[model samples]
Target: MKDEKFNILLADDDPDDRMFFQDALDELSIQATLSEVTNGSDLMKFLENNLNKLPDVLFLDLNMPSKSGMECLSEIKKHEKLSQIPVLIYSTSANPEVVEILYNMGALYYIRKEGDFSCLKAVIGKALFLCRNTRLIQPERPDFLILVDDIRPKLPL
Candidate 1:
């Protein structure tokens, strides 16, 4: 299948981390338009500014200065147009509770921040794949990030 183009919104406080992920995405040859926001309030402003366009995927950092990732995810999920977009919690925190909570809140996946490109590639690959499929309704299992070979359940949209 031909790959579809997409716009990815990354909300993270750390510039270095953002660049790392961007590099990984570039290496993967994934066609995407990346937009970044440093904090939750900035993310909200970004969403407002891009009034007509909703991001295909959102990579949200759990902790931020003004508004936390949790807050941003909650706010986005509450909105009709935004709720349909996939939100992935990207963070340094490996806390299971955080993952569970976000998953239940409709996050597509909760992936921990890794120090290298290979790890980043896995996350990016999963995100790109998820974006390609329109069937997924609720957030997928956290293990989906680890189980790359399994067939994803086809959601009836």
Candidate 2:
């Protein structure tokens, strides 16, 4: 079978962060097709429009206009077809409550966006690598890949 190009849905209000992520992905040599949304509403619209091409991974920003990241996470997880696709919360805020709430709500990972462009590259590289490998589990990665508990909260529909 042909190796499918990984589709990544990146939702962020900041234009700079969006562009930066795209550039960083290229620099990291992670093969992916990225789709972007500025807010939760846009994200929902995008998903509704492209149901056939749902993203393999979702990179979400917590604070966004129209709707919030946490709200979006809740909605995405509630969907039947979309729930299986891993959703990673990538935000600037490292708020413990936000992290806990997202984790509790079934987010695959909660990543705090930080550092220079190089740092972003490293995080993205690791995320993609871990995501591509399912059988091989390891410690000290990001929150999303490290959680192996299958009995966790199922997306509420």
Q: What is the TM-score of each candidate against the true structure?
A: 0.85, 0.83
Error of 2 at 91 (Å): 0.2
Q: Write the per-residue lDDT of candidate 1 for residues 94-154, one digit (tens) a residue.
A: 7777777888888877777777667667666766776676455554474534332332232
How badly does each model clash, as a count of residue pairs? 0, 2
Clashing residue pairs in candidate 2 are 108-144, 109-144
lDDT of 2 by residue, 6-124 (tens): 89999999999999999988776656788899989999999988889898888999899999988888888899987777888898877677676677788776666755765566667
Q: Which pairs of residues have clashing backbones in candidate 1?
A: none
The parts of candidate 1 lying over 4 Å away from their true place are 139-157
**Model 1 TM-score, 2 decimals:** 0.85
lDDT of each: 0.76, 0.74
Best by TM-score: 1
lDDT of 2 at 19: 94
